[model samples]
Every structure is written in C-alpha cells, then in structure tokens.
Target chain A: MAVLLLADVNDGALATDAVAKALSAVKGLGEVHILVAGTSAAAAAEAAKLDGAAKVLHADDAAYDHGMAEATAALIVSLAGGYSHIAAAATAFSKNVLPRAAALLDVMVISDVTAVVDADTFERPIYAGNAIQTVKSSDAKKVLTVRTASFNAAATSGSAAVEKVSATADASLSKWVEDKVAASDRPELTSAGIVVSGGRGVGSQSDFALIEKLADKLGAAVGASRAAVDSGYAPNDWQVGQTGKVVAPTLYVAVGISGAIQHLAGMKDSKVIVAINKDEEAPIFQVADYGLVADLFNAVPEMIEKL
Target chain B: MKVLVPVKRVIDYNVKVRVKADGSGVDLANVKMSMNPFDEIAVEEAIRLKEKGIATEVVVVSIGVKQAQETLRTALAMGADRAILIEATADVHTDIEPLAVAKLLAGVVKEEAPGLVLCGKQAIDNDMNATGQMLSALLGWSQATFASELAIEGDTAKVTREVDGGLQTIAVKMPAIVTVDLRLNEPRYASLPNIMKAKAKPLAAKTPADYGVDVAPRLSVVKTVEPAGRKAGVKVGSIDELIAKLKDEAGVI
Candidate 1:
C-alpha cells in the first residue's frame, strides 16, 4: 500500500505542505514514494526527500518544462499501476491532470482532500469548505489531490536515493508553449496561515493599499473577492472564491466584503473568520467569528495604527 | 473561421450549497443553476471574436443533463450561432472527469473543425481547469490556458496569458485551444432582442455515445460532511484591544 505523491515542479517543487500532509495521513501504512516530473528533476528530488519520501523518482525532459497537464496526467497514470494510492497537491496542474488519469485507470479520484482516515478513506470539504465529507474508496486504486493548507507540512528531513525514470512523451498531445507566472513576493494564498481579503467595499485599487498595510502588519497573504477582482481593484490571482484559490488559513480577515456564496467557497475553511464591513446585514457576518460594522476608510487606518 | 466554445451548468454562484445528511454529496434540491461564470467569459470572448470579424461563426457545446440546455440558451442569447448539449447522467462536479469531457469535446472539434476553441479557465463547480488543456492534447493542437488577451492574425493566434508571476504572450497556430481567464473580458448580459433571437437559434441534443466517449464516474464520493464549525472569538471593544489580542494571543502581528 504505497502512497505515491506526484510532485508538480512549477510552483517551486511539490507543494511541500500538501505532500507532508498526505504523507502523514498514511505514514504508517507503507513507504512514501515521490514521482518528480519537470526540467529541474534535481530540485524536485531534493524537495521530495525533505518531505520524508523513501524514494524519489525523477523524470526529466524538455517536454516536462511547461508542465502540460494532459501529458503529466498520462505519465502519472502510466506509472500509477503499482501504487494503491496516488496523491498530488490540489494545484492547477493536479486539478487539471489527475482526474483524467484516474478515469483512464478506471478508478476513483478524490480531490481537495484535507485529511485521510486510513489508506482507503479520506476527508474533504464540500460546498466551498462550508461542509466536510468523509469518503471511502471501494475500488482497488484511489487517486487524490490534497489541499496543502489543511494540515501541517511534514518536516522530516532525510536524504533519499534518487532514481531516474524514463517517462514516454506524448507528441500527439498539445505541449505548453509558455507559462506566465504571476510574480509575487508574498506567500501563496492557498498555503498561507493568515489571509486578509478585500471586497467591493474597498472602493478603488488605491484603497487596497490599506488592506495591504493591514496584511503586512499581520504578516498575512492578501486576497480579494471576485467582485473586487472583476471590478479591477485587485489582480485575478488575489481573487478568492469558487473561481479562485481555496484557502484554509488559521485566520481570515475580510474587509468590506459582502460575502457572496462564491466568495465564501474559497475562504470559508479558515479556523477563525473576522469580517469588517459597514453593512450590518452583510452575509459575511453570518460566518464571521468577529464582525465589525464600520467604515473601512476609518477602520482600516485605525486597525493599522493599533497594530 | 469558426469558433467553438464549451460551457457548463453548475450550481449558481450565488446559491449556498448544503451537503446531504447521508454523506453522499451536496444537496441540490431547489438550488439555482447557472452557466458557469468562466464559461460565460468564454462564450463572450468567442462572440466578441465573431463580432470583430476574426471568427465567422460561433458554436456552443455543453455536457450534462437536459437542463444544461438552459445554460446553452443563455449562451445562445449572448450570441452563439448554434448550441449542442451532450447529455450525461453522472454528477457534473464529483463524477465525470475532465479527460472524458475533453475526449468528447475532441470528437466535436474533429466534426466541427473550428479554427479556434475557447473555454473558461476552469469550471467553478469542480474547479478542475482541465478540459481545455486535455482537449488541446487530444486534438494535438497548441493551447493557451488562462488567457487574458487574444488576437488572431492570419493562420496564427497571439494570446496573452496570466500566470502566477506575470503576463506572458505566446503565439499558437490556428486550430488552437484557449482558456479564458476572469480578466479576459466582462461578459455582456443578454438583451431582450437577443433573448428573443435565442429562442429561434438552432440547438441540437446529443449523447456521450454520439461523441464516442464513455461518460463514467472516475471519482467516487465517499461521503459529504460539514466543515469544522468556527467558534466565535472575543470581540474587542477598541482597536488597541484587537491589536493586543492579535499580537499576544494569536501572535499574528
């Protein structure tokens, strides 16, 4: 019952936190093996080893450069025959690739899993993290995508033997011509422990500066509602909703957000929710642990000053 | 140049979903369903391309139950020339996988041979973000995922993609697939005239077998449960108290 972790290379190696959580979820069942695919196989190997992987399988090829989701999925399925469970971070690549592989293998794929009760059962969120569901796979093979922030990233450090594996490239499949990664110095929202989000109440892009300051003070990642992002007050990457990244932070501070259902789907998993809005009847307050009814213009600056 | 657009009907973005008490899946009873917001962007992009003379015709397709046609009608109302609904019985989010949909879409592409294929970056329900890429792979065509800007010139299409770091511009030859990002374009609402026109538009119903694809549940739902409830925390009377709690207790500051 080996748990195989598919390490996607682009987001700076396997999502370490997700890998660690997946490993810890099934630590006692069997050995953990990580399959690293990308142009930088060595970096993947090193990262996988740090996550308590017993062995690292490296597949380095030019075709793996842009991380084409289809090719990667095909390769994983090809290699997944022997493993009982296949896991990967619920990133863009895994979200796109793994389900197809599971279908090809004629097995069940469990996605966005936050916990694993045993080798065969898993726990995950539904309805945008507003609800949790436990699932048990009846099939022989189980494919899963782990939400990186749900559990603490494994910190077991040990050098693992790296073995080179040849992954057949599918020329018939479309290749990624290029990738334009959004450059950011801040922590990735999905993995951040604390997140500060702005909503339609921000009024303008310049007002986001206040949210940014509050985030900086709290050392938190910045997020936005679909309304804010669509209104062009923030970049799409900052958007948090059904359409954006799903986050499970220890604390999520929503500023001036009206808390649409779509927006709740993204950050509702936070352990503690703090909502600051002028609208006393905003739906966000329904889910908030701490609700503040005040003008953001005065509240944000005051909050920053207090911090 | 004919353009192909794929749309999906999902739980309306505005409706709150409840997990079934039986732990089977989400409770969809009386839940409002709508065309995926991202797919709307794709349909909007394809329509805009046709309006701008880059595309000669626009065809919309969806994979779901018969009710999905309502979503197709919405797309048609927005200006798609025709619509095709590939009916399937599996749950759209938890059961049917993206690869299967891609295979089905690939068959449609072969029959239609559209010069360009446009889809949303990902459907909000599953948020898989795979169909477009998988379709491109199955068709052996170039792909531009998360495209914010797109332009067609001659036999090639220039696309500006939004990634994690910044914008990247890439040029792929015609007969390529492009996934529309949220920033791609603001989708237009269907006007009264277009709504009336949509009623007269051509819409065809088909099955997964029609595309020669097996629609099966690659994923199984173990159970559906509620997330952990958050306990209410102390509400500070002043900003200073809030900061003190955050710094001393939460240690977030």
Candidate 2:
C-alpha cells in the first residue's frame, strides 16, 4: 500500500512542513508519493523532491491556475482510487476540498491528524486541542489532513525524476474569479513555531501593538480568538478557532483569553502553552503549561519588558 | 429582493459536551440547545439589509428536527419575515454533514429563488463549514466564504473575506452565497414588539422528501471518545524554581 500526499499549489508547494511531518510520522509503513496539481508541475515536482518524496505525480493544466476547490476535489477523487490512504495539509483549500471528495467517494475523512499510529489508526485533537483522541478507520480508503506545524519541513535532496501526466478539469463547476492573497511578510500562522494570541480582554485593536511587540521579540506570529476578532479588537486573519486556522506551534502564549473550546480547537496542539489571564480559573489554564494569573494590562507589558 | 438565511440549531456554546460511554455520540440528554451563534449573525445581516431597503423580504430556513423550529422562531423574533423548518427525525446532530444540508438548501433555493443567500461560515457544533461553498458549487453561483464585509452594487456583490494569511476582497454576481464570519456584524436582541410579531408570523414545516434530497450520512462516526486528560503540574512559588522546572522538566530552556 502507498501513502499519497495531495500537494496544495496555493501555498506554491507541498507545504514542506506538512510533507516532512507526514513522511516522518509514517516512516516505515509505505512509499510516499507526492501528487502536485498546478500549472507548473515541474516546479512542484522539484519542491516535492526537497521534502524526500520518492515519486512525484505531476498533473499540469491551465484550468488549475486559480485553484478552484471543486475542480481540485474532482481530480483528487478520480486519482484517489489507487492509494490506500490520502493525506494533505490542513490548509484552507484542503479543508474545503478534501472532505467533499471523501464524501463523494463514500469514505471516511480524518482531519487535522497530528500522528499516525498505523495504516488505519491515527491520533487527532477533538475539542480544539484540549483533548486528543485516537481514531481507527475501517474503510478501504482513508483520507486525512495533517497539521503542518506538528512536523518539520523535509530537507531538500539534490534532485528527483518527474513524470508529467495530463488531467481533465471540470469546467462546468464554478471557478475562482480572483484570489485576494493576504499581504504579510511575517511567518504564516500554520507554519509558525511560536504564536501569541490575544482575547477580548485586550480591549481594542491598538492594544494588539503590545502583542505584536512581544511576538516580534520572539519572532512569533500573532493570533486572536473569535471573541477578539468579533469584538473588532483584531483582524480576522489573526483569528484562531474551528472556523479559523488550525495551528500548532512550539511555544503558544495566550493573553487574556477565557479559553473557549472553539478557540482551543485551533491552537491546542502547541508544544508549550502559556496562558495569562486575570481570572485564574479561566479554562485556558486547564491546558496551559505555565499559567500567569494577572491582568494582561500588567503582564503583557512586563513580558515585553522582560523579553 | 428576497433574502434567504439558513440557520442551524446546535448545543449551546457554553455547554460542555460529554461523549457517550458506548461511543455512539455526545450525550445530549437535557442539554440546552440554541441557534448557532454565527447563524444569528447571518440572520442579523439579512434583517439589516431588509431594514436598509436593500432587500424587500427575509425568509429563514432550517434543516433539522421539529426542535429546530424553536431556532427559526428565534430568527423570526429578530425580524425575519417567515420561517421554514425541514423536519427530519434522524439524529441530525450526528449524521448532519455540510454537503447534505447544502443539497437541501439548493432545493429550497430552487423554489424560493431568493436573490441573496446567507449562512454562517461554520456551525459551532461540527464545524464542517462547507454548506455555503457546496451550495455555491451545486448551483454554479459565486461564493464569498468567511465574509467580514459585504456591499451590493447594481448587479454584483463585493465581499471582503477573512482568510488565513489576511483579508481578501472578491466580487461576485448577484444571487451569490455569502457566509458570515465572526466579525461580520453584531446581532441585535429581539425586541418585545418583534417577539410578539414573531408569534403571529407564518412558519411552514416540510420534510426532506419535500425538497427531494437524501439526508444519508456520507461520513460515519467510527466512534466518539473524550480527549486524554492533561496531567496537573506543580505550581512554583519562585521564578527561579519556575525556570529550573522549565529547563529540567518541560525542557523549553
């Protein structure tokens, strides 16, 4: 049996971190085949080789330029018949496309998987990252989405052979008219090693300056809860929850968060969780490795000062 | 222009769900249920549009059991013109997938032919977040997921979406599906007068067959289990001990 990694082209590559982690997680089980779907299949093939993929399946088409989820899902479903299991990074496109394909194929999809126990068994977070659950898929074909932050990006090898294959696109489906990519030079939240999140307790968007300061000090990315984003304390890009980006970082510092389960679903997989809240009994402390019971007004500034 | 808003009834956000011993599903015995918080935002946005004269009528739709009508009523009380409840006795809480629900909504859209469709970006319960996009795909209509801002032009709608990297602005033709994000708008509380008006408002009830959609579970739950409990660590009184523990035990330093 072979493990097929569905490479998302929107990120311009296999999301190297997700590939490395998935490859590392299932090292001894099966040969890893990285499938690249894009206009430039050769670029994706070269990138996949850097992640230690044994073989690269390149599906190049002009219709793929916009990264339409429907067309992408259709392609994956058609090609999925060959592999025992399919995996992709839990990015926005993967989150929207893969499950629909799995449902179309009448198979089970295990999402945001952090570990692979066996061919069919895996470990993933259920309630945000507060609780980890072990799952076993009984279906003949299994689909899984991996959290890129959980594993390291595969080191680049010198080169690999690429095989080009032409695939059909469903033009009848709706196409992406335009992509408004976020303009940011900072590390992407899903791939960041350190994340600093704020909550409604921050008061206003101006208060995010302090969070940004500390994040800059640690070279970390900034995140926010649904409460903070809804309250207009921060931008939606900074939001973290079941509806937002699912992230795993080495160090996650949550400031002024009450730790709602929905919010926890996004960042619970971090290696070290530190929560700072005036309310000592906040649910965030339940999962935090280091808890600071104080007003964020005082603690955040002091953290910036100390760092 | 008629506005269509789809709402879902889910466990109250404040309620802590417990998995059943048999792993069949979450134990919902006597647990309080409420309209999904994001759906409330969608309903609010539609009502605001109607009030602003951007829309002439607002129709609320929900797909679930009879209990879901309570949620539709909540929407009606908040100023929706009418309510339609698609009745299903099955455990929608378990078998409910986004695509199945979207297929049902597509059928309703065919009959209603509303000019605008709005839904929450995701329901707090399962967090599938695919119905709006799936509906858009099935209908071949334009879509704006995770919408934070929306404005209507002559024949198109401009939406600003909240994506992982940042904000994205997309323009889609009329009769598009727009999913509400958290920051979209603040939902208004139901006034006493509106609450009274909702009691007299018409609520039509139907079944899955009425819409000609299959509500089968495309994805089955192999099992539902509680997360592993984290071990409690000792609290140190001094920063030095904290530093020592961090370096020796946690290994961060």
Tens digit of per-residue lDDT, candidate 2, span B194-231: 88889899999999899787777644555667765654
- Whole-model alpha-carbon lDDT for candidate 2: 0.75
Question: All candidates' TM-scores?
Answer: 0.87, 0.86
lDDT of 2 by residue, A1-307 (tens): 8777777665454456555666665544576777778877545765556545677778788766555566777778778877888887776666666665665665656777777778878776554453355667766887778776566667777355566766898754344445556566667677787898999988899987888887887788889998998788887778887778777788888888998888887877678887878887888888888877777787677666655
Scored against the true structure, residue B102 in model 1 reaches a CA lDDT of 85
Please give the C-alpha DockQ score of model 1.
0.35
Each candidate: chain B TM-score: 0.95, 0.95
After superposing candidate 2, which stretches have Cα over 4 Å from the reference? A1-4, A10-14, A22-33, A40-43, A50-54, A59-63, A74-86, A99-144, A149-160, A167-185, A295-307, B90-94, B236-245
What is the iRMSD of the candidate numbered 1? Answer: 3.7
Write one digit per residue (lDDT tens) for candidate 1, span B212-240.
78866554566677666655444555666
Clashing pairs in 2: A128-A265
Model 1, residue A184: displacement in angstroms?
4.5
How much is A131 displaced in model 1, in angstroms? 4.4
- Residue ranges of candidate 1 with Cα displaced over 4 Å: A11-15, A25-30, A99-109, A117-121, A130-141, A167-185, B20-23, B90-100, B153-155, B165-174, B231-234, B248-252
